[model samples]
Target: MNSAFLFGLLGWLDLFGIAVFATSGALAAARKGQTLVTFAFFALVTGVGGGTVRDLLIGAPVFWVQDSRVPILCLAIALIIWVTPVRIWRAGAVDWFDAMGLAAYSVFGAAKAMQLGIDPVPAAIMGIITACVGGVIRDLLAGEPSIIIRPELYVTAGALSAFSFVALMQTGMDGIVAAAIAFAAGFALRALAIVKGLALPVYRGAAEDE
Candidate 1:
């Protein structure tokens, strides 16, 4: 794939991931009966927090700061939620969006890190950060238990996506093809978690320690 075209596709995927996450944030604010301003705040932070961290760690400009449209996209999501009735928000809609974001952002982040000359293992870690940190920020700000701690396969799903992409790329697969397979792998895991309550088993302390 053309390098420029690959970056363009990755950028679009990142934006789509941001939109899904931002909408989830806005919906969270709506659930809490927060003001529209709060919705915007939550949306922006939740949409960009992970990528911001990723960029900072990589010594790159913060993504939302560099792109004028990123914050605007966050604001748009908040506005959409503000104008819509909660009744219109279907059950499990947020989970579906989250799953999509988890898949898309993981692959996008890994790809970008690889482009920036990051080592493959760390690049995959960056992908997980891009996929989950925003949601963590949202959860903390909203005073909810962080989803990261939940006994679900959330981060594992993201890791699988990121790892899949990196592994495929190492095998000389096309970036776009690798990304598609990675995203599907992650989203499938999350879908099973949501639909079937699949989760990682909680660790139990040693019997003597307990």
Candidate 2:
């Protein structure tokens, strides 16, 4: 509930999220027959990309660089997946990992911003960046479209989680409690979106290009 305990919890969540993201990214590289170098590249980028961006924007030290554990954890996760059977990298596992990463990063971003004395709105936006930038970078490196640009409810889920965290903070809820609720909400929404093919409605302008 206190700031110290809240931060420790956030650190654990961030590590767990990075591991899951790395595993998913490594599995994707393996499926594409990428070499070990490529696997490590994907794992590192998918694990630390979002957090790096968020920290840079906020003028905080780059997290993984500050704590070697993050990158090491990511590599370990990738190695484990690489040695495992291919079936473990099935679509369902990917979805679950993605959901978990989204939730964890959203909470991490919001909590970090709050600690740094950022306003609620910007903090919420930071949360979205923390949740989506890793996936965007990973997809771009994999020669796939960035998920944030797609209508797959990815950013929406992050926004919802971030806003929830901010609202709870404004209401004087403890940081850890707010973070846990925000993570669960985002994860549930993302899982449902994946299952039901849910998406935000797109605007259609009269212009041909639009």
Number of the predicted model whose lDDT against the real structure is largest? 1
Model 1 Cα lDDT, one tens digit per residue, 124-189 = 999999999999999899998898888778999999999999999999987878889999999999
Residue 72, model 1: Cα distance from true site in angstroms? 0.3
What lDDT does candidate 2 reach at residue 7?
Answer: 64
Q: After superposition, how far is residue 1 of candidate 2 from its true place, in Å?
A: 7.4
lDDT of 2 by residue, 1-210 (tens): 366855688778888878878876886688677877788889999989888999999999998888988888888877777778777567567567877898888878887887888888998899889888888888888887777877778888888888998898899887778888998999889988888878987876656576
lDDT of 2 at 151: 73
Each candidate: RMSD to true structure?
Answer: 1.3, 1.7
* RMSD of model 2 against the true structure: 1.7
Return the number of clashes found in candidate 1: 0
Candidate 2 structure, TM-score to reference: 0.94
Position 46, candidate 2: lDDT: 92
